[model samples]
Target chain A: MKVGFVTPRYGPEIMGGAESAARMLAEHLQARDGVEVEVFTTCALDHLTWKDELPPGVGELNGVRVRRFPSRAGRSAAFYGLDGRLRLAPREASLQEAERWVQLNGPVVPALVDALTRSDLDVVCFYPYLYYPTVRAIGRVPMPAVLHPAAHDEPALYLPVFGRTFASADALCYHTEAERRLVQQVYPETAATPQLVLGLGVATPPPARRPGGEVLGLGDRPYLVSVGRVDEHKGSVMLARFFAAYKERHPGPLALALVGPVAAEVPAHSDVVVTGVLDEQDKRDVVADALVAVSPSALESFSLVVLEAWTLGVPVMVNGTCGPTREHCEHAGGGLWFTSYEEFEVGLERLLADPGLRRTLGQAGRAYVDRHYRWPVLIDRYLAFLEGVLARGKGRRGSSERADQLARGRRAQALA
Target chain B: MVEERLVAEPEGDHAQELVRRVMAEVHQEAARRRVEGGLQASELAELDELFARHAPVGAKGQRLADVLRHVDARSFVDPVVPVASKKAGGSALKRSIRSATQWYVGFVAHQVSQFAAAVSRALHVVDGELQAIHRELELVAPGPAPVLDLAGTHRVDGWWVAPVLAALDGVPGRVLHGGCGDGWLVEALGQRGCDAYGVDPRVDERTSRVDVRAEDVAEHLRGLAPASLGGVVLSGVLDGMAPAQRHQALEAALAALEEGGLLAIQAATPAAWDRPEAPGEVDLAPGRPLRTVGWEALCRRLEVAAEVREGPAGMDLLVLARARGQGAR
Candidate 1:
């Protein structure tokens, strides 16, 4: 059976959590038997600018088909003006205003939406729900639609318009149970929607015992690594600040390595190193020898880096407010979490001091990853979930048809 | 208050114990620091208050459950209509007309208000029922601490496993044993040439058997494709359930079984449960033993061929039902 994925941006170079998850799912699912995976996305590479970097057209990537449609406009100045007003009181906005809010959060790719409507795919999966492509194109498609909301407890999730977006799906796939709870709590009607908390799969990185400190220029001073785009939303600034404070409290050789593309203004500190963008091999190598892999993002649906670190037998310290990461720590026995600077300082001190605790937690985390997040295990569940969705969709259609028939018969009898 | 050990070396693959230990130590340190004023008490209180306010965003005591509560509390719909207009003597004239038609208008308005109030009440019922269903579904959904944690450590065997296996000997598809903790009975069923799996609300993480799911048995049964299972063995499930839960389990089990399939339930007699030797867990379970006569009546109500067999000296009872091959609607 064939399934299509719809996302605003798509590519290998894109670094957003949801986009990376979509690409990984597409690639892995393509390898599965009796399943064909296709991607319906825009030609954008950068999320912030929404520039049409990649050429638009159907192309093949690793044997899977990709259809990239050029966007109509980039992120506009007017969007920020409107966004500022809406974020203050999103639930109170009028329906028209909500629609405008979605449209203004742009990459407004009409051609991509049109392609999705005209396509004959049996099922369509829309990733990371808060986008023009997903909000506009989800329920409008002819085939059964599955929405992967990847929602957080942010103000945007409380917007009046998302209730309908969530309700329109034939099913939903969530990255974590925390995500599922958050979405359903806001839109309670979705409790009835057929869903699977199918968290994204994590492929085990290649076993390479390369020295990580040398690669990141740390040179054996035990460093804490934060992998991913250095963005304010992902808590890069907060983490950097906390690290500097910790350094002042306990002066030592412990370095902080922010190893990803820099997008946020992380203040320059002597101990904190921002290795602007590394290759995948270098990133893994850096993570492999880290004292602790810190995922500072408070809004992660599923922090993939934590799983990657676990796959390398490294413990993690997460932002306590983020449900998915805290859940990862609790479930895997993999790490600890901190909600404040004080908690962060104390937690970091404990981790830096205890080698035995670190190894035990790290090994537990590895076991947890192996038990659940392997590509084959997650993809098999996903494929089965897709089949279940198809069956449920048929059932819904049959029931609606019967209801239609009954209504028509009643109307005809009244006329007679 | 900081604990000595944060994380213990896991015995083989059981690291959850270590996680618990570590979390304890962390919380302990936080508590000690707060008491000793390393971080000011005022600051800690403010932080705790902030976390407490925002932590349960979509959790219980939140919006979905309370959506209709506003209506419930203020269900009285206003029925007043304006009587004044800005014209010479218009106010007096309108008042006079209103007074003349007051009885009829008031009666009609009251009826309409009551109708609105009734609709709100019905909506409240529907909303409440939906929330209840959501909670029940959540009991089995794949989340952290997925199990319901109601099942106890006291296990029963030796009396019913053989009979259940014999009853379901040649069953031709997947067989499910509900409340199969640690999966001893499921293994016995497997050894008896049946493709059996188990589901228990209390799951042992280190069990090594992937087929044993951590979920509510009734909810698990409901999730299956209709008429899919060849046989069903319900052991140690019904004795502690409320009446509605018991009925739901029975219905789900019967619905899941294919036509001509076997349905077996092994339960203890009330005499055994009420005896002083019994564990008396579940805060005195409400649906204990369901009496042999009640089981027979329940079988009859379900409308399937069945037999009720009392164990030696009336310690337990087994009810076996053969499905008439009905659809799973």
Candidate 2:
């Protein structure tokens, strides 16, 4: 069966969880027996323009066909307020500017439309609902489509319209319960029906000793760790405050490592080491060395960092407010929660003081994650769901007569 | 109080009026469709009998002209009219007028209002068929909660753990299980040397250790001291409450916990409860179905240093610490 995977971002330019998930799914499906997978994504990077030529229309990538359409690179520039040439104005003005720019130079929308019209695929799966162009294009397509809404915030924005549109789709896939609930709340009409529920996969890191090789003050001392984009939403500020409080109570040389892409808006703090944008290897190394992984985000649909921490057999400290993070932590049995600054400080202190508790939570977390969020298990479920959707579609097309006849025969036999 | 009554009555009346108007419109459309189908004299006579049995009764002083006027003005503007026109056009137009006349006579005989009397009669039959279909579908599709309950029981087994050491305001103390559903973790906590007790709402009052009533979570908390209860275990409770009930539970849990008391909150991850239901039955379930809050939002709302932890049993564990100051904001 031919399947088309539509995403706003992909491959070497992979920036977010959804893009990575799409790439992995496409690869796995293509490699599987009796499945032909094709990926259609936007090309936004300039220096890597050669990737655009690698697969012009459709070419093979690890057995799957990949199609790259060059999107307007600076579309996020206005949202980020990076370009000085573009005036910083009202939201409406910025939107107008962004729309004008996309109309003039972007191939994101047209390319999606072209792909939809050109491809003779059985099914199309759209990733991340907020990417307006892809969503709009998917809506226009007459064939059966599946939507994998990767985050809570995106659905919260387009749910009023998307909820109705979703009813027409073959299925809607959600990674986290929080995201699903948000969608259900907005579209109450679709709450009683059972839709697809597929788990998300975490990347497997290479085998390595715990970072600093389990040394005490000499190498690996107890330090609370958090890795993600450094923003207020990520809870970097909260982490900083907690770490400071932790230090005052314990009075150790333990360093709180904050690793990931840094935002200019979220200020850096003393004693909190910010490693901005580490490569994959370095990230793994950091996770291995950290005493405990912390996700302080106040608005995460699902924390990939929590999974990374689990893979490394490290305990996680997660913000309790986010639905997915709490779910992941509790399910894994490998984390602690701190609802307030005082609670965070106390939880951190307990973890720091007790090595046994940290080890226990860490091991439990890894075991929990391996059982549920493992890639192989998740991929199998995803494949089955996709196949089921195709089968359901087949049955929907005038095949009720045979079933009706079978039912009549059963009824007649019962009467006899 | 008088003002409130006066305002509420008018609003209620307006809503009733709207429902009546819509119902009248439906009847008129059905009658027009029937007539358009070119019913013979015998068929018209049968339809008159059908209208007498069906439509909303007692539309006072209704006449054939009034019904015609209502039908011409309102029914023509309806979206269903075009579809009906296409389905049964030429013959239906003639049949519909005849059937409508019969309906008017029936309405006049029944002593209903002229404008809606004919519509009410025709709609009565259509509404019954629609209601029967609705009832049949409901029987086929039993509510999702019972199924969820079964699935939840099987999936949530053997995934319990006693929190290593319960802390209250940076001080260690014995943890008590105030309300442990299923005893999965209560048993685990008992083994771990924490003073854990199983409190089941379902258990016989004589046998149960603690009678944990849904309404008395606060009263239950009154048994513990300000800084004595190290941790409160609320598993699968908050998500199962109405909004007001959830608020009460949270408030009670916060109030009961000591300053800096650890609240080990494990809820069914939103992902587990994320499946979309069919349209129109979203709120039919008694309690909220697990996907109550995002982890971040819950942490933020609870106003504690929060971490989203994964339990060994694949349940989302929120190990929240009580704020040292007052309860959660």
Candidate 3:
């Protein structure tokens, strides 16, 4: 079976949440027999500028062919102004204005749409719903499309354009049940399309030594670690404030290590250390030795860092407001949750004080990862889902024919 | 050592010990204030603290706190006596003043007591009436329906039961012929080695021959027990009900069917009613059949595995077999 992946950006240079997930899946799928995988993406590496870093041509990475198309234009100040105006009152944006907003949102590649419309693959999977590559290109394609919306509760998802994109797909695969519920709440018509909650498979890393206590210039002080992009939206500010308050009350020797891309300013504290974007092995090493890994983000489709920490036999603490992460902790029983500073302090204190409890939670978490997230098992489930999709479309004129009919119905309704 | 161990274990003798101590303290305090005729307000306040601090977890502790705070009965009472003396010169004037004051106090107390009793009775009656109204509203008001566009799924035409009955020729069981319009479908099912009975809103001279009754389909289904029927044939019954009603009827039918029992459903397609040769036998006044996509979505929502067959004659047949160990959803 020939498959195509539609993403805003591709390759190892571009490391975003949905991009990484798509890359991992594309690489793993290429290794399987009887399946030929290709990535159709923009030539841009940076989402900020959407500049054509890579030449507009075909390239090969990890044995999978990739076709890159340069974006027609990058994001603009006018777009930002419009964004601010529309977000104040989301429903006020006109249909034509929303269409223009999709273009100005960047990764606007016309050639990619042309390519997608011309090519007929067995299955074409669109990664993430935020980009023009997905929202615009998806509706134009005639092939059987499976959308990995990676949806969250955001204003953009409610746009009429997105509703049209959701109606055009044959099936949708979500990273978590929370994401699926959000989609259902937003687009009730999607119930006609098949859906599956298949999260990205994490590759099992080989056993590695923990980073020495003195290796990162920390002496004998026990500390908690948070690994992700340090941004206000990602709850870095919240974590910093809570940690400071905890320090003031307890006056402990505990330190907090923040590691990842620094998107927001780190609060200046003697005990808080910000390590921006470490290598994969080094990141794993840091996680292995940490007392507890914290996922403070309240808006995650799936927190890869939490799973990665679990794989290293480290228990995690997640924000209770994050549905996906909290659900993981619930299903795995390998972690705890905190909705406020008081809860955070209590959870951190308990985990830090009790080594036995920490070990029990960590072991449970590792067992969960082994049971549900093994790469081969996940790939098999994906194959089975694909099989189901194919069967549902079989003997009918096409799967999208019904979706198109529904799309037309929606159009009529919109006009009415 | 035993007391310490019990204290460590909250469920042990520590609980009984605490209860005994609280009761002893309460009795001692009550006795210490007996000279004042009744337990003082200060004593009750102290007892409240004791109960709150020593209250065990759960309902017993709550009960203890509530009882201690509301205890109002006193052990002692003041005695009253009538006086009559005729020995002194000013005895008549003093006796007259005392008698008038006593009589006035007694009359006011009696009226106040009577008014309190009346107020209490009125309050009780009002509470009872409010509860009755609440219950009535609960029965009258509808529950929230599932938030899906179920409007289009309830209007299918009913003439398509013929093809469905023709397909169920070899099926065997006690068939519940739902919406047995004019008893034709039930009569057909009777010849197929099945005990067929039907319920419909419209029962006439035709239904006199069979065990058919005039009743709403959803209402009849709701009356049956779980796993009571061998099979259910829903023919044109789902087209004329509201979304919630249709969902309830489907749930009832699924629950009523025995394990491995067959469920044969025939509903009008989107175009069934518009056809020039649409079957004019069954009357579908307010409801229309679900469109193709709408029906598929409804089935998906119901989570029932139905083998759908689209007919060329503006109708669709969905044959389902009840799975074993299927419990109420």
The candidate maximizing lDDT is 1
**Model 1: CA > 4 A from native:** A393-416, B1-13, B39-280, B283-329
Query: Second chain of candidate 1: TM-score?
Result: 0.56
Q: Which consecutive 10 residues in model 2 chain B have the weakest lDDT in total?
A: B1-10
Q: lDDT tens digits, residues B1-329, model 2?
A: 00111112222233234323433443455455445644344433332322222111222224343333333333211112222344547668856665667655555544533444457557655666766887899875533221122114222242434232333223333344433543445445544544344333332221122211211232344333233344676655444444555555565555445466667665555444444532222245445544324655655675666656655544344455554533334
State the iRMSD of every prediction, in order shown.
Answer: 8.1, 28.9, 20.7
lDDT (C-alpha) at residue A281 in model 3 = 75
TM-scores, each model vs. reference: 0.67, 0.49, 0.59
lDDT of 2 by residue, A276-317 (tens): 787777678777778788887756656778887878878877
* Whole-model Cα lDDT of every candidate shown, in order: 0.72, 0.52, 0.66
DockQ (C-alpha) of model 3?
0.02
Q: Any runs in candidate 2 off by more than 4 Å, and if so which?
A: A45-60, A72-108, A154-161, A192-194, A213-218, A248-250, A265-270, A394-416, B1-329
Output the lDDT of residue A218, model 2: 30
Q: Per-prediction TM-score, chain A only?
A: 0.93, 0.79, 0.93
What shift in Å separates residue B171 of candidate 2 from its native position after superposition? Answer: 62
The better-scoring model by DockQ among 2 and 3 is 3
Clash totals for all candidate models: 1, 77, 4
Q: What share of the true interface contacts does each candidate keep?
A: 0.17, 0.00, 0.00
Looking at model 3, residue B249 earns an lDDT score of 78
Please say which candidate is ahead in lDDT: 1 or 3.
1
